[model samples]
Target: MSKSQATPNSAATGAESPDAILFREGMSRAAAAVHVVTTDGEAGRAGFTATAVTPVTDSPASLLVCVNTASRSAQALLANRAFCVNTLGAEDLALADIFAGRTGLQGQDRFTVGAWEKLETGSPALTTSLVSFDCRISDARVVATHHVIIGEIVGIRLGERKPPLIYQGRHYHKL
Candidate 1:
């Protein structure tokens, strides 16, 4: 049985406390698409590399993105109430590292490394991303150390099909 299945009664019996480290380790095995979530508005322009964006619904064309509450971009994203999810291609590995803060650049400085353009929401959309979703924040809730943002898609930009950049096992993968 899987670890999650084995722990079915853990929450009820309090017999097996959830281990954060173990949970993260298990999650690391799962592959996730890499994206750069960006925003530009009165709050200022900000962007960050992320892997926690997912579709939440289709009726209203919505997506959910988890942003670290302490991240520098969080304040701007919240204040602006708009964002763009730029799905990266395999060639964007270096761009990902820059936006992820591996290069020590912050705020608008991150944009200097990539070509960008504004979409419907005025958020910075990556010019060569595999795909870009411009959205308006429909709602947001803080959970633990992250802010769960619900975005209503307003525009979408599609680029040439290419191998996507994926994150798994604490590393990048191309597929």
Candidate 2:
């Protein structure tokens, strides 16, 4: 059968149904870069590891970052109206784990584990990140259990060229 001519089961239900499991499983096969999204302001300093980030357009130099609405950093990200997407290098796995909440760290404590500096938005940017995009939140929309944040690039920091940290099939890979 041609690629698009084949169809999987069509009896799947809604997001909370078995289809959700299947959907997650399917997504696991796709490789994505790992990043630590950080924000700091009146709300507070907060950061989290995530893979759900992408460029939306270059005309405006914007990107989208998806954060769970219940994430510890959500409030700060919204209140600050800005963030920094720190793309990790392969050597930053432990940093990613700390931000991912695997180390039981919270809020500013996560920053203690990494080297950080402030960028255009005054958001904490990773000094050792492969690259960091400092941005201002242009818009935010809630979808399912997460907030899709639209960020307009205000500044960008490029670090040394190195293998990036990637996630696929529930594991981290360097490339």
TM-score of each: 0.94, 0.90
Scored against the true structure, residue 103 in model 1 reaches a CA lDDT of: 94
**In order, what lDDT does every prediction score?**
0.93, 0.91
Candidate with best TM-score: 1
lDDT of 1 by residue, 65-100 (tens): 999998989999999999999999999999999999
Superposed by TM-score, candidate 2 places the C-alpha of residue 166 at a distance from the truth, in angstroms, of 0.3
lDDT digits (tens) for residues 73-138 of candidate 2:
988899999999999999999999999999888778888887899998999989889999999999
TM-score of 2: 0.90
| Residues forming the 10-long window of minimal summed lDDT in candidate 2 | 10-19
